[model samples]
Target: MATDIPSPDARPARSGRRSGDSTTRTDILVAARTLFGENGFTKTSMRAIAAEAGVDVALVSYHFGNKRGLFSAVMEIPGDPVLRVTTAAAGPREDLGRRLITTFITLWENDDTGVALRAMLRSAVNDEGAATAFGDFASGAMMPAIATTTGLSTETVRAIGSCIFGLAVMRYLIRAEAFTALTTDDVIEQFGPRLQAIVDADT
Candidate 1:
């Protein structure tokens, strides 16, 4: 009978594979975000991101499809717009305005979400695709959700989107003096009721 002994340095292949996969994906995202911030999206390519991540270029495509998908991943908005809107909708219909505003505020204040949001917004001004992407998500996903929740018409939903977008612009984008002077609670208390009235007025 012959006995075989494994080498001392040998380890489980599966565990090593799992660790590498996790680390690689995270590295790609970090690299992409850094480069996107420094050079903007169009200037950054898969190869650049791959080099920064110390991985093969194919791996970028494997994980994130293309720059658009990768940028979307980097944005990492919490629960996605659809999920967030649906969640806000689940609460009291009468409370939908306040809940939705609070939800938007929370998304805007969180570190990761807020950073990506501001980046996307800033880029959108010069980049049509970015503008369309953000606009579509806001108008397409969120508007309908609010309309459905409050039983409001399409026009009313646009009004709701306008208000929320303006709020984000004032607080996150421009940091307007008049809006910045007020606290989050103050904005919520003052503006929230007016939003509620829009929903309430719809038949």
Candidate 2:
């Protein structure tokens, strides 16, 4: 007679609360929030969070996928920023700047993504750790990807990122009437070509 096999869910439950438990997840989040605020995103290591939570480092990955994922959780960011920006960069070289400007403007206007983005920007402006994390994400990952796609130097791409960053700060953070009063298309029409100029600097 063939023996009956146990289904995956029917298997014996683990004895402890450490195995994918809600309490464990809460511990990690609490630890991550404290560290991320105190040390900033770039400076706070996953290992430190794991240690602080009294859990294995792998649990951090299991719970959040990676450092950025963990940061997104701690910061309540809705999605992967690198993926979003790089995806926007994908297209013909001529419109790279336009696409980027459009992307940032769209992100700013959206309710779900915009609030988290503005919060992060506010934190970055005031906190050194948050600033470094933003710089690294832009200069290290996002800028390099845009540079490769557009044949522009990372410095040039970074300049464009800075311009958009300033736009965000002015429009949202400072609530400057000049920037806030303009329609999305107005902002894009004015700034797009200026960003494109940096892209075309070498040409």
Q: CA lDDT, every prediction?
A: 0.68, 0.74
TM-score of each: 0.62, 0.78
Question: Superposing all C-alpha atoms, what RMSD in Å does each candidate have to the true structure?
Answer: 12.4, 9.5
Tell me the lDDT of candidate 2.
0.74
Model 2 clashing-pair count: 0
lDDT of 1: 0.68
Best by lDDT: 2
In candidate 1, position 90 carries an lDDT of: 78
Worst 10 residues of 1 by lDDT: 1-10
Question: Among these predicted structures, which one has the highest TM-score?
Answer: 2
In candidate 1, what are the lDDT values of residues 48-152, reduced to their tens digit? 677667776677778877665676776554335665667776777788789878877777777867787777667766665556555555565567766776677
Which stretches of model 2 miss by more than 4 angstroms? 1-17, 34-45, 127-129
